[model samples]
Target: MNAIIVTGGDIDLSLLESYISKNKYTIVISVDAAVKKLEETGKLPNVMVGDFDTLADEKRLEYYAGLGIEIVRHNPVKDFSDTELAIDWAYKRNITEIVIFGALGRRFDHTFANILMLRKYKKLGVDITVVDRCNRIYVKSNPFILEKRLVWGKYISFFAVKEKVFIESLTGVAYPVENKYLDNIENPSLFISNEIVDDYMSVIFDGEILVVESRD
Candidate 1:
């Protein structure tokens, strides 16, 4: 089954509703302020995890608890992030895939950390993707196909997370490459702003690469 972990970050309400309606997410876990966001949508999460620092309203807490939503409250001084705790809860249930919402926000550190979490969990054989208003990010180290139909946005960009990444073959995109090594971080647009020309794009690469699909 697939799980969705909602973080307390910037979220587009319409987009969140779209995902909630269309996607058959078996486990819905909200972290901290995201619980309120989910509540605003008139839907309840299966489980809520957080320290309740930001959401300190007593009545609201009782309201969700009254609805039988399992609330996993933690200490404010805990080491792990609220979102990380939510991921752990969902992953422990033998979930096959995890999609994170509200990961991108005003805070760059939180957003970047959420992106890295994708790579960390993907190594554990869990298919994880971080989705927001304009981007869908995940780390890929194997050959994969990025079809236009399933692509998150019109443009796809690749950011190397490792020291060096060697792309073996790339096709079906506007700027196709073969046997190219992306090792430098100097140029930010080295493998960015690419679009699928035809029906799909194929990428075969070595080392960790953060594949970013954006509306631009």
Candidate 2:
């Protein structure tokens, strides 16, 4: 089943609307306060997962239930964050290719944590991505291709999540670099902001690579 995940980050309604309009999916999982954003967009998520710490009042919780939204509650002190729980729930349901929204443009720690969660899910063999108005982020451990689209972000950064990533080729970008090693924990900027120039671009990595396609 196709699914979309919304996390508790500052959301861009325009981007969210456009994304949902293009896809026909059975579920949209809202993590934490992201459920409110989904409601503001006039779209109710099929399932909502969070601790509800941010829900100021019981009435707000009732409002969600009144909409027939399935709410999954967790202890605020749990080990996994709300976003991780939502992701796990999706995985268990055999949902493939989850597009995560509202995971960027928020607290730096949350943003970083969510990105790491994306990497973790990469091991589970699910195609996951985090999207916002200006960027689309994902992690890859193997070769992947991106078709020519105008760069959404002013810059594109790639960091080695594993040990090393060997970039095979790049095109249609401003600072195109090919066959380069994106070493982990050291010299992380080697693959930052390499633009695209042609109809397509490709990368072959020996280890995991976190691709952050961002705009200014």
Candidate 3:
């Protein structure tokens, strides 16, 4: 089953609503301030996990408790971020796919850290993705097919998360490549700003690559 974790960051309400309505997420978790935002949408999370430092309303907490929502509290002094804790909780349940919302915000540090969390849990065998209004961010180390043309995010870009990443093949893109190498040592400008020219696209790569499918 898949799980969606709502985190404490800037969220695009329209996108959030679109995802919740169209996707059959098995479970939904709210982290700290996200609980209030999720509730504002007239929907309740299945679970709430966080230190609760940012959640100020005492009555609202009581209301959630009364509804029998599972609340997992953590010490504010802990090492992992609230979103990480929530992901760990889902991992413990043997969830194989997780989509994170509200991961991007005005705070660049937190946004960067959240993106790195994808690397930290890369070996957990879960397909994790961080989504916002204009972007879908994820890490890849193998071949995958972009099966359909995205309606929102039109441009696809790839960055080498490792020192070097060898792409076996890139097709169905405006600027296609065959057995290309995207290494930090070389000029890494070739892989950015690619657009889908066909019904689908495919990328096969070696090593870790960070993919951002986005639009203006």
- Overall lDDT per candidate, in order of appearance: 0.86, 0.80, 0.87
Among these predictions, the greatest lDDT belongs to 3
lDDT of 1 by residue, 102-147 (tens): 8889988888788878877788778888888899888887889977
Residue 21 displacement in candidate 2 (angstroms) = 1.7
lDDT per residue for candidate 2 within 1-216, as digits (tens), equals 779998888788877877788888779999878877887778889998989888656788788888898888999999987888999999999986899997777599888888888878888878788888778888877777776574466566788787776676655567766777778667767778776666677666577778888877
Judged by TM-score relative to the true structure, which candidate is superior, 2 or 3?
3
Error of 2 at 154 (Å): 5.5
Ranking by lDDT: 3, 1, 2
Question: What TM-score does each of the candidates earn?
Answer: 0.95, 0.89, 0.94
Q: Regarding TM-score, does 1 or 3 come out ahead?
A: 1
* Model 3 accuracy (lDDT, Cα): 0.87
Off by over 4 Å in 1: 184-188
| Clashing residue pairs in candidate 3 (N, C-alpha, C atoms within 3 angstroms) | none
Sequence-dependent TM-score of model 2: 0.89
After aligning candidate 2 to the native by TM-score, how far in Å is the CA of 140 from where it should be? 1.5
lDDT head-to-head 1 vs 2, winner: 1
Per-candidate RMSD, Å: 1.3, 2.1, 1.5
